[model samples]
Target: MTLPSAMTFLLGGLLLAGSVLSKENPAELAVPRDTTGKSQWVANHYKRMMALADKSPEKFRIVFVGDSITKKWLDDSGSLWADNFGSEDSPFYALNLGVPGDRTDHVLYRLKAKEDGGLGNLDNPAIQPEVIVLMIGTNNLFPPHDAEQIAGGIGAVAKRLKDLRPDSKLIICSVIPSNSAQKDEELVIPANATLSALAESMGDDVRYLDLFSPFLDGQGKKNTECYEDGLHLNEKGYEVWFSELMPMLKETLGLATEN
Candidate 1:
Protein backbone atom coordinates (compact mmCIF):
# COMPACT_ATOMS: atom_id res chain seq x y z
CA MET A 1 0.00 0.00 0.00
CA THR A 2 1.16 3.46 -0.79
CA LEU A 3 1.82 5.74 2.15
CA PRO A 4 -0.42 8.81 2.13
CA SER A 5 1.33 12.11 1.69
CA ALA A 6 -0.47 13.69 4.63
CA MET A 7 0.62 10.91 6.92
CA THR A 8 4.15 11.20 5.63
CA PHE A 9 4.13 14.92 6.38
CA LEU A 10 2.85 14.34 9.88
CA LEU A 11 5.43 11.66 10.60
CA GLY A 12 8.17 13.88 9.20
CA GLY A 13 7.12 16.65 11.58
CA LEU A 14 7.10 14.30 14.52
CA LEU A 15 10.53 12.94 13.65
CA LEU A 16 11.92 16.47 13.41
CA ALA A 17 10.41 17.39 16.74
CA GLY A 18 11.64 14.22 18.39
CA SER A 19 15.15 14.83 17.11
CA VAL A 20 15.16 18.39 18.45
CA LEU A 21 13.59 17.53 21.80
CA SER A 22 15.98 14.64 22.32
CA LYS A 23 18.98 16.94 22.41
CA GLU A 24 18.07 18.96 25.49
CA ASN A 25 15.64 16.79 27.41
CA PRO A 26 17.20 15.52 30.60
CA ALA A 27 14.93 12.48 30.44
CA GLU A 28 16.77 11.44 27.30
CA LEU A 29 20.00 11.00 29.20
CA ALA A 30 19.52 7.27 29.42
CA VAL A 31 19.00 6.87 25.67
CA PRO A 32 20.97 8.18 22.74
CA ARG A 33 20.25 11.86 22.12
CA ASP A 34 19.09 11.20 18.53
CA THR A 35 16.26 8.76 19.17
CA THR A 36 15.04 9.53 22.67
CA GLY A 37 11.30 9.63 22.23
CA LYS A 38 8.15 7.64 22.95
CA SER A 39 5.93 9.65 20.67
CA GLN A 40 3.10 7.78 18.97
CA TRP A 41 4.69 8.45 15.60
CA VAL A 42 7.97 6.91 16.67
CA ALA A 43 6.13 3.96 18.17
CA ASN A 44 4.09 3.59 15.01
CA HIS A 45 7.16 3.24 12.80
CA TYR A 46 8.66 0.63 15.07
CA LYS A 47 5.35 -1.18 15.38
CA ARG A 48 4.98 -1.32 11.63
CA MET A 49 8.42 -2.84 11.32
CA MET A 50 7.67 -5.38 14.04
CA ALA A 51 4.38 -6.28 12.43
CA LEU A 52 6.15 -6.96 9.17
CA ALA A 53 8.69 -9.07 10.99
CA ASP A 54 5.89 -10.98 12.71
CA LYS A 55 4.16 -11.62 9.41
CA SER A 56 7.25 -13.23 7.86
CA PRO A 57 10.49 -13.11 9.73
CA GLU A 58 12.46 -15.09 7.17
CA LYS A 59 11.33 -12.83 4.32
CA PHE A 60 12.80 -9.74 5.93
CA ARG A 61 16.20 -9.96 4.35
CA ILE A 62 17.64 -6.45 4.01
CA VAL A 63 17.70 -3.44 6.32
CA PHE A 64 18.98 0.03 5.50
CA VAL A 65 20.26 1.66 8.67
CA GLY A 66 21.38 5.21 9.16
CA ASP A 67 19.96 8.74 9.45
CA SER A 68 17.45 10.74 7.40
CA ILE A 69 19.13 9.72 4.17
CA THR A 70 17.91 6.22 4.79
CA LYS A 71 14.61 7.26 6.37
CA LYS A 72 13.54 9.28 3.35
CA TRP A 73 13.39 6.18 1.17
CA LEU A 74 9.74 6.03 2.17
CA ASP A 75 8.96 9.27 0.39
CA ASP A 76 5.76 8.71 -1.58
CA SER A 77 7.13 10.04 -4.85
CA GLY A 78 10.34 8.06 -4.90
CA SER A 79 10.12 5.22 -7.40
CA LEU A 80 13.77 4.49 -6.80
CA TRP A 81 12.60 2.49 -3.81
CA ALA A 82 9.56 0.91 -5.42
CA ASP A 83 11.18 -0.12 -8.67
CA ASN A 84 13.80 -2.04 -6.76
CA PHE A 85 12.45 -3.46 -3.51
CA GLY A 86 8.71 -2.75 -3.38
CA SER A 87 7.40 -5.67 -5.37
CA GLU A 88 6.42 -8.97 -3.79
CA ASP A 89 8.13 -10.75 -6.67
CA SER A 90 11.39 -9.03 -5.81
CA PRO A 91 14.17 -11.20 -4.42
CA PHE A 92 14.83 -8.91 -1.46
CA TYR A 93 12.54 -7.74 1.29
CA ALA A 94 13.88 -4.69 3.09
CA LEU A 95 13.29 -2.62 6.19
CA ASN A 96 14.16 0.98 6.86
CA LEU A 97 15.53 1.46 10.39
CA GLY A 98 16.85 4.91 9.81
CA VAL A 99 15.85 7.60 12.26
CA PRO A 100 16.21 11.25 11.31
CA GLY A 101 19.26 12.99 12.78
CA ASP A 102 20.83 9.74 13.93
CA ARG A 103 24.57 9.64 14.36
CA THR A 104 26.62 6.47 14.68
CA ASP A 105 26.03 6.41 18.44
CA HIS A 106 22.29 6.70 17.93
CA VAL A 107 22.23 3.86 15.39
CA LEU A 108 24.32 1.72 17.74
CA TYR A 109 21.82 2.51 20.46
CA ARG A 110 18.87 1.61 18.26
CA LEU A 111 20.34 -1.75 17.31
CA LYS A 112 20.45 -2.83 20.94
CA ALA A 113 17.53 -4.52 22.68
CA LYS A 114 15.32 -2.63 25.15
CA GLU A 115 17.30 -4.14 28.00
CA ASP A 116 20.33 -2.45 26.55
CA GLY A 117 18.59 0.88 25.80
CA GLY A 118 17.72 0.11 22.14
CA LEU A 119 14.41 -0.23 20.39
CA GLY A 120 15.31 -3.12 18.06
CA ASN A 121 14.78 -6.00 20.50
CA LEU A 122 17.48 -7.71 18.47
CA ASP A 123 17.97 -10.37 21.10
CA ASN A 124 14.99 -12.00 19.39
CA PRO A 125 16.38 -14.09 16.55
CA ALA A 126 13.31 -13.57 14.41
CA ILE A 127 14.18 -9.94 13.80
CA GLN A 128 17.60 -10.67 12.39
CA PRO A 129 18.26 -9.30 8.89
CA GLU A 130 20.43 -10.94 6.26
CA VAL A 131 22.08 -7.70 5.20
CA ILE A 132 22.48 -4.27 6.76
CA VAL A 133 23.43 -1.21 4.67
CA LEU A 134 24.99 1.36 7.00
CA MET A 135 25.76 5.00 6.20
CA ILE A 136 26.26 7.55 8.95
CA GLY A 137 28.77 9.99 10.57
CA THR A 138 27.79 12.94 8.40
CA ASN A 139 26.00 14.55 11.34
CA ASN A 140 28.97 14.01 13.59
CA LEU A 141 31.07 16.18 11.27
CA PHE A 142 29.05 19.27 12.18
CA PRO A 143 31.08 20.60 15.07
CA PRO A 144 33.69 19.69 17.69
CA HIS A 145 34.21 16.34 15.90
CA ASP A 146 37.31 15.78 13.82
CA ALA A 147 37.42 13.32 10.93
CA GLU A 148 39.09 10.68 13.06
CA GLN A 149 36.48 11.08 15.76
CA ILE A 150 33.67 10.72 13.25
CA ALA A 151 35.32 7.64 11.73
CA GLY A 152 35.81 6.19 15.19
CA GLY A 153 32.14 6.63 15.89
CA ILE A 154 31.32 4.74 12.69
CA GLY A 155 33.82 2.04 13.65
CA ALA A 156 32.11 1.63 16.98
CA VAL A 157 28.79 1.28 15.18
CA ALA A 158 30.20 -1.41 12.86
CA LYS A 159 31.62 -3.36 15.80
CA ARG A 160 28.25 -3.21 17.54
CA LEU A 161 26.47 -4.47 14.42
CA LYS A 162 28.91 -7.37 14.20
CA ASP A 163 28.27 -8.35 17.79
CA LEU A 164 24.50 -7.86 17.61
CA ARG A 165 23.86 -9.35 14.16
CA PRO A 166 26.78 -11.63 13.55
CA ASP A 167 25.18 -13.33 10.56
CA SER A 168 24.32 -10.15 8.67
CA LYS A 169 26.55 -8.94 5.86
CA LEU A 170 27.39 -5.24 6.23
CA ILE A 171 27.65 -2.79 3.34
CA ILE A 172 29.32 0.21 4.89
CA CYS A 173 28.83 3.15 2.52
CA SER A 174 31.16 6.10 2.33
CA VAL A 175 29.37 9.16 3.62
CA ILE A 176 27.85 11.05 0.68
CA PRO A 177 29.24 14.41 -0.34
CA SER A 178 27.56 17.61 0.84
CA ASN A 179 27.49 21.06 -0.78
CA SER A 180 28.23 22.90 2.43
CA ALA A 181 30.30 26.03 1.92
CA GLN A 182 32.50 25.22 4.87
CA LYS A 183 34.89 22.97 2.94
CA ASP A 184 32.88 19.78 3.46
CA GLU A 185 35.50 17.85 1.48
CA GLU A 186 38.01 18.32 4.24
CA LEU A 187 35.97 16.24 6.64
CA VAL A 188 34.11 13.94 4.24
CA ILE A 189 37.25 12.83 2.40
CA PRO A 190 39.26 11.73 5.40
CA ALA A 191 36.22 10.31 7.14
CA ASN A 192 35.42 8.23 4.06
CA ALA A 193 39.04 7.10 3.87
CA THR A 194 38.80 5.99 7.46
CA LEU A 195 35.53 4.22 6.72
CA SER A 196 37.13 2.39 3.80
CA ALA A 197 39.89 1.26 6.12
CA LEU A 198 37.37 0.24 8.76
CA ALA A 199 35.45 -1.87 6.27
CA GLU A 200 38.69 -3.54 5.21
CA SER A 201 39.61 -4.31 8.81
CA MET A 202 36.24 -5.98 9.47
CA GLY A 203 37.09 -8.84 7.06
CA ASP A 204 34.79 -10.15 4.29
CA ASP A 205 31.54 -9.73 6.19
CA VAL A 206 31.91 -5.99 5.65
CA ARG A 207 32.09 -4.29 2.22
CA TYR A 208 32.80 -0.61 1.59
CA LEU A 209 31.00 1.26 -1.17
CA ASP A 210 32.18 4.75 -2.05
CA LEU A 211 29.09 6.89 -2.62
CA PHE A 212 30.88 10.22 -2.53
CA SER A 213 32.56 10.35 -5.90
CA PRO A 214 29.44 9.80 -7.98
CA PHE A 215 27.90 12.91 -6.39
CA LEU A 216 30.88 15.16 -6.97
CA ASP A 217 31.33 17.56 -9.86
CA GLY A 218 34.37 18.27 -12.04
CA GLN A 219 35.39 20.89 -9.49
CA GLY A 220 35.10 18.30 -6.69
CA LYS A 221 31.97 19.96 -5.25
CA LYS A 222 28.66 18.24 -4.75
CA ASN A 223 26.58 18.17 -7.92
CA THR A 224 23.92 20.79 -7.31
CA GLU A 225 21.35 18.87 -9.36
CA CYS A 226 21.56 15.91 -7.02
CA TYR A 227 20.85 17.78 -3.80
CA GLU A 228 17.86 19.87 -2.76
CA ASP A 229 19.90 21.45 0.00
CA GLY A 230 23.62 21.39 0.58
CA LEU A 231 23.25 18.19 2.57
CA HIS A 232 20.10 16.31 1.64
CA LEU A 233 19.58 14.53 -1.66
CA ASN A 234 16.61 15.28 -3.86
CA GLU A 235 14.71 12.59 -5.80
CA LYS A 236 17.30 12.87 -8.54
CA GLY A 237 20.01 12.32 -5.98
CA TYR A 238 18.24 9.23 -4.67
CA GLU A 239 18.14 7.89 -8.20
CA VAL A 240 21.85 8.41 -8.53
CA TRP A 241 22.53 6.77 -5.22
CA PHE A 242 20.40 3.76 -6.05
CA SER A 243 22.16 3.35 -9.36
CA GLU A 244 25.47 3.05 -7.56
CA LEU A 245 24.07 0.78 -4.89
CA MET A 246 21.98 -1.71 -6.90
CA PRO A 247 24.85 -3.63 -8.47
CA MET A 248 26.64 -4.11 -5.18
CA LEU A 249 23.42 -5.35 -3.63
CA LYS A 250 22.82 -7.80 -6.46
CA GLU A 251 26.32 -9.16 -6.04
CA THR A 252 25.97 -9.47 -2.30
CA LEU A 253 22.70 -11.37 -2.69
CA GLY A 254 24.28 -13.62 -5.32
CA LEU A 255 21.77 -12.60 -7.95
CA ALA A 256 22.55 -12.57 -11.68
CA THR A 257 24.70 -9.53 -12.52
CA GLU A 258 22.32 -8.56 -15.30
CA ASN A 259 19.68 -6.21 -13.90
Candidate 2:
Protein backbone atom coordinates (compact mmCIF):
# COMPACT_ATOMS: atom_id res chain seq x y z
CA MET A 1 0.00 0.00 0.00
CA THR A 2 1.03 3.57 -0.67
CA LEU A 3 2.07 5.51 2.51
CA PRO A 4 -0.90 7.85 2.18
CA SER A 5 -3.34 4.92 1.88
CA ALA A 6 -1.82 3.20 4.90
CA MET A 7 -2.12 6.45 6.96
CA THR A 8 -5.81 6.77 6.00
CA PHE A 9 -6.50 3.15 7.05
CA LEU A 10 -4.67 3.61 10.37
CA LEU A 11 -6.58 6.80 11.10
CA GLY A 12 -9.89 5.06 10.36
CA GLY A 13 -8.99 2.25 12.75
CA LEU A 14 -8.09 4.74 15.51
CA LEU A 15 -11.38 6.59 15.06
CA LEU A 16 -13.35 3.35 15.33
CA ALA A 17 -11.46 2.38 18.48
CA GLY A 18 -12.19 5.78 20.00
CA SER A 19 -15.89 5.40 19.25
CA VAL A 20 -15.92 2.04 21.02
CA LEU A 21 -14.19 3.52 24.05
CA SER A 22 -16.62 6.42 24.16
CA LYS A 23 -19.56 4.02 24.11
CA GLU A 24 -18.19 2.16 27.12
CA ASN A 25 -21.03 1.47 29.57
CA PRO A 26 -21.77 5.06 30.54
CA ALA A 27 -24.97 3.90 32.17
CA GLU A 28 -23.31 1.31 34.36
CA LEU A 29 -20.24 3.39 35.17
CA ALA A 30 -20.48 5.29 38.44
CA VAL A 31 -19.31 8.85 37.84
CA PRO A 32 -18.28 11.11 40.68
CA ARG A 33 -20.83 13.41 42.34
CA ASP A 34 -21.02 16.67 40.43
CA THR A 35 -21.20 19.86 42.46
CA THR A 36 -20.82 22.59 39.87
CA GLY A 37 -22.91 24.84 37.62
CA LYS A 38 -26.51 23.62 37.37
CA SER A 39 -25.79 21.01 40.03
CA GLN A 40 -23.97 23.17 42.57
CA TRP A 41 -26.72 22.65 45.09
CA VAL A 42 -25.88 18.96 45.22
CA ALA A 43 -22.91 19.56 47.50
CA ASN A 44 -24.98 21.17 50.21
CA HIS A 45 -27.64 18.52 49.93
CA TYR A 46 -25.04 15.79 50.20
CA LYS A 47 -23.50 17.41 53.24
CA ARG A 48 -26.90 17.68 54.88
CA MET A 49 -27.67 14.03 54.24
CA MET A 50 -24.30 12.83 55.52
CA ALA A 51 -24.70 14.91 58.68
CA LEU A 52 -28.24 13.66 59.18
CA ALA A 53 -27.02 10.11 58.72
CA ASP A 54 -24.41 10.69 61.35
CA LYS A 55 -26.86 12.34 63.72
CA SER A 56 -30.16 10.53 63.18
CA PRO A 57 -30.41 8.16 60.23
CA GLU A 58 -32.85 5.85 61.98
CA LYS A 59 -35.51 8.56 61.94
CA PHE A 60 -35.68 8.26 58.18
CA ARG A 61 -37.83 5.29 57.33
CA ILE A 62 -38.37 6.31 53.73
CA VAL A 63 -35.67 7.63 51.38
CA PHE A 64 -36.66 9.33 48.12
CA VAL A 65 -34.11 9.30 45.29
CA GLY A 66 -34.19 11.11 41.93
CA ASP A 67 -33.38 14.35 40.10
CA SER A 68 -34.66 17.95 40.19
CA ILE A 69 -38.23 16.74 39.98
CA THR A 70 -37.71 14.80 43.18
CA LYS A 71 -35.81 17.62 44.88
CA LYS A 72 -38.58 20.11 44.09
CA TRP A 73 -41.17 17.89 45.75
CA LEU A 74 -39.25 18.01 49.01
CA ASP A 75 -38.85 21.75 48.62
CA ASP A 76 -42.42 22.52 47.53
CA SER A 77 -44.61 19.75 48.91
CA GLY A 78 -44.42 21.21 52.39
CA SER A 79 -47.46 19.93 54.30
CA LEU A 80 -47.92 16.97 52.00
CA TRP A 81 -44.71 15.48 53.35
CA ALA A 82 -45.10 16.69 56.93
CA ASP A 83 -48.76 15.72 57.38
CA ASN A 84 -48.07 12.23 56.16
CA PHE A 85 -44.49 11.30 56.92
CA GLY A 86 -43.11 13.72 59.48
CA SER A 87 -46.08 14.44 61.70
CA GLU A 88 -46.43 13.16 65.24
CA ASP A 89 -49.28 10.90 64.11
CA SER A 90 -47.35 9.53 61.15
CA PRO A 91 -45.95 6.02 61.20
CA PHE A 92 -42.88 6.75 59.11
CA TYR A 93 -40.26 9.46 58.67
CA ALA A 94 -38.62 10.26 55.32
CA LEU A 95 -35.56 11.86 53.79
CA ASN A 96 -35.04 13.48 50.39
CA LEU A 97 -31.82 12.53 48.55
CA GLY A 98 -32.78 14.07 45.26
CA VAL A 99 -30.13 15.92 43.30
CA PRO A 100 -31.33 18.24 40.54
CA GLY A 101 -30.15 17.59 36.94
CA ASP A 102 -28.60 14.30 38.03
CA ARG A 103 -28.55 11.40 35.60
CA THR A 104 -28.52 7.71 36.52
CA ASP A 105 -24.74 7.46 36.80
CA HIS A 106 -24.52 10.41 39.14
CA VAL A 107 -27.03 8.79 41.44
CA LEU A 108 -25.12 5.53 41.26
CA TYR A 109 -22.09 7.50 42.32
CA ARG A 110 -23.91 8.80 45.37
CA LEU A 111 -25.26 5.37 46.20
CA LYS A 112 -21.95 3.52 45.80
CA ALA A 113 -19.37 2.97 48.53
CA LYS A 114 -16.95 5.80 49.39
CA GLU A 115 -13.93 3.54 49.10
CA ASP A 116 -15.15 2.91 45.60
CA GLY A 117 -15.16 6.72 44.98
CA GLY A 118 -18.89 7.36 45.52
CA LEU A 119 -20.56 9.38 48.27
CA GLY A 120 -21.20 6.13 50.18
CA ASN A 121 -24.49 7.15 51.78
CA LEU A 122 -25.96 3.71 51.25
CA ASP A 123 -22.96 2.11 52.90
CA ASN A 124 -24.16 3.33 56.29
CA PRO A 125 -26.32 0.75 57.98
CA ALA A 126 -27.98 3.41 60.09
CA ILE A 127 -29.40 4.90 56.89
CA GLN A 128 -31.37 1.74 56.19
CA PRO A 129 -35.08 2.23 55.53
CA GLU A 130 -38.24 0.20 55.28
CA VAL A 131 -38.65 1.31 51.66
CA ILE A 132 -36.59 3.30 49.16
CA VAL A 133 -38.55 5.15 46.45
CA LEU A 134 -36.57 6.06 43.31
CA MET A 135 -38.02 8.30 40.54
CA ILE A 136 -34.95 8.97 38.39
CA GLY A 137 -33.89 8.63 34.70
CA THR A 138 -36.05 11.37 33.18
CA ASN A 139 -32.88 13.29 32.51
CA ASN A 140 -31.41 10.30 30.74
CA LEU A 141 -34.49 10.01 28.53
CA PHE A 142 -34.13 13.67 27.65
CA PRO A 143 -30.75 12.76 26.23
CA PRO A 144 -29.70 10.51 23.33
CA HIS A 145 -29.70 7.36 25.48
CA ASP A 146 -31.92 4.46 24.44
CA ALA A 147 -34.32 2.61 26.75
CA GLU A 148 -31.90 -0.26 27.38
CA GLN A 149 -28.94 1.92 28.30
CA ILE A 150 -31.00 4.12 30.58
CA ALA A 151 -32.57 1.10 32.22
CA GLY A 152 -29.14 -0.37 32.73
CA GLY A 153 -28.05 2.79 34.54
CA ILE A 154 -31.16 2.89 36.69
CA GLY A 155 -31.02 -0.84 37.31
CA ALA A 156 -27.48 -0.64 38.61
CA VAL A 157 -28.55 1.84 41.22
CA ALA A 158 -31.75 -0.01 42.16
CA LYS A 159 -30.06 -3.39 42.42
CA ARG A 160 -27.24 -2.01 44.53
CA LEU A 161 -29.62 -0.27 46.92
CA LYS A 162 -31.55 -3.51 47.44
CA ASP A 163 -28.36 -5.52 47.72
CA LEU A 164 -26.99 -3.17 50.35
CA ARG A 165 -30.10 -3.43 52.46
CA PRO A 166 -31.45 -6.87 51.68
CA ASP A 167 -34.47 -6.69 53.99
CA SER A 168 -35.64 -3.26 52.73
CA LYS A 169 -38.11 -2.78 49.90
CA LEU A 170 -37.58 -0.76 46.69
CA ILE A 171 -40.17 1.02 44.58
CA ILE A 172 -38.93 2.05 41.09
CA CYS A 173 -41.19 4.72 39.64
CA SER A 174 -41.49 4.78 35.86
CA VAL A 175 -40.13 7.80 34.01
CA ILE A 176 -42.77 10.52 33.86
CA PRO A 177 -43.63 10.90 30.17
CA SER A 178 -42.39 14.01 28.42
CA ASN A 179 -44.56 16.44 26.43
CA SER A 180 -44.27 14.39 23.24
CA ALA A 181 -45.84 10.96 23.04
CA GLN A 182 -43.62 10.05 20.13
CA LYS A 183 -40.54 10.61 22.25
CA ASP A 184 -42.11 8.79 25.14
CA GLU A 185 -42.83 5.87 22.86
CA GLU A 186 -39.27 5.90 21.66
CA LEU A 187 -37.63 5.93 25.08
CA VAL A 188 -39.81 6.44 28.15
CA ILE A 189 -42.29 3.62 27.51
CA PRO A 190 -39.68 0.93 26.98
CA ALA A 191 -37.62 2.18 29.90
CA ASN A 192 -40.76 1.88 32.01
CA ALA A 193 -41.18 -1.69 30.92
CA THR A 194 -37.61 -2.55 31.73
CA LEU A 195 -37.99 -0.92 35.13
CA SER A 196 -41.01 -3.10 35.79
CA ALA A 197 -39.06 -6.20 34.82
CA LEU A 198 -36.07 -5.13 36.85
CA ALA A 199 -38.23 -4.65 39.92
CA GLU A 200 -39.82 -8.07 39.53
CA SER A 201 -36.48 -9.78 39.05
CA MET A 202 -35.18 -8.15 42.20
CA GLY A 203 -37.84 -10.11 44.10
CA ASP A 204 -41.12 -9.58 45.96
CA ASP A 205 -39.81 -6.77 48.09
CA VAL A 206 -39.16 -4.64 44.99
CA ARG A 207 -41.88 -2.87 42.98
CA TYR A 208 -42.26 -0.71 39.86
CA LEU A 209 -44.57 2.25 40.28
CA ASP A 210 -46.21 3.57 37.09
CA LEU A 211 -46.10 7.36 37.40
CA PHE A 212 -46.11 8.11 33.67
CA SER A 213 -49.73 7.71 32.57
CA PRO A 214 -51.20 9.97 35.25
CA PHE A 215 -49.10 12.84 33.88
CA LEU A 216 -50.41 12.32 30.37
CA ASP A 217 -53.84 13.57 29.24
CA GLY A 218 -56.32 11.30 27.52
CA GLN A 219 -54.90 12.48 24.20
CA GLY A 220 -51.50 11.28 25.50
CA LYS A 221 -49.80 14.63 25.54
CA LYS A 222 -48.17 15.49 28.82
CA ASN A 223 -50.80 17.40 30.80
CA THR A 224 -49.63 20.98 30.64
CA GLU A 225 -51.75 21.93 33.60
CA CYS A 226 -49.80 19.51 35.72
CA TYR A 227 -46.42 20.88 34.67
CA GLU A 228 -44.68 24.12 35.46
CA ASP A 229 -42.19 24.13 32.56
CA GLY A 230 -43.29 21.20 30.44
CA LEU A 231 -40.57 19.36 32.36
CA HIS A 232 -41.01 19.82 36.08
CA LEU A 233 -44.30 19.33 37.89
CA ASN A 234 -46.53 22.03 39.32
CA GLU A 235 -48.73 21.48 42.36
CA LYS A 236 -51.24 19.69 40.15
CA GLY A 237 -48.49 17.42 38.91
CA TYR A 238 -47.41 16.77 42.49
CA GLU A 239 -50.98 15.82 43.29
CA VAL A 240 -50.86 13.32 40.47
CA TRP A 241 -47.54 11.97 41.76
CA PHE A 242 -48.70 12.13 45.36
CA SER A 243 -51.83 10.11 44.68
CA GLU A 244 -49.73 7.30 43.22
CA LEU A 245 -47.11 7.55 45.95
CA MET A 246 -49.53 7.59 48.87
CA PRO A 247 -51.00 4.24 47.94
CA MET A 248 -47.57 2.69 47.34
CA LEU A 249 -46.27 4.00 50.64
CA LYS A 250 -49.20 2.53 52.52
CA GLU A 251 -48.94 -0.82 50.80
CA THR A 252 -45.18 -1.12 50.91
CA LEU A 253 -44.74 0.11 54.45
CA GLY A 254 -47.71 -1.99 55.54
CA LEU A 255 -49.58 0.94 57.04
CA ALA A 256 -53.28 0.38 57.75
CA THR A 257 -54.33 3.78 56.34
CA GLU A 258 -52.99 6.97 54.81
CA ASN A 259 -51.94 9.58 57.30
- Report, for all candidates in order, the number of backbone clashes: 0, 0
lDDT of 1 at 97: 70
Q: Each candidate: what lDDT?
A: 0.74, 0.82
Highest lDDT scorer: 2
Q: Candidate 2: lDDT over CA atoms? A: 0.82
Task: Give the range where candidate 2 is weakest over 10 consecutive residues by summed lDDT.
Answer: 83-92
Model 1, 1-259: lDDT tens digits are 3569888988999999999975542211224552246555665666775565466565667878888788787773278677776554567677677666667766666777787556763556776777888888777766536677677777787887788889899999888886564546667788889889889989998999999899988997779988877778889888888888888888888888884
Each prediction's RMSD over C-alphas, in Å, is 14.3, 3.8
Best by TM-score: 2
Q: Write model 2 residue lDDT over 134-241, tens digit each, in one string.
A: 988888865658888888888988987887888889999999977666768898899888888888898899998999888877896778888888678887888888
Clashing pairs in 1: none
> Candidate 2, clashing residue pairs?
none
Give residue 18's lDDT in candidate 2 (0 to 100): 99
**Candidate 2: where are CA atoms >4 Å away?**
1-23, 36-39, 87-89
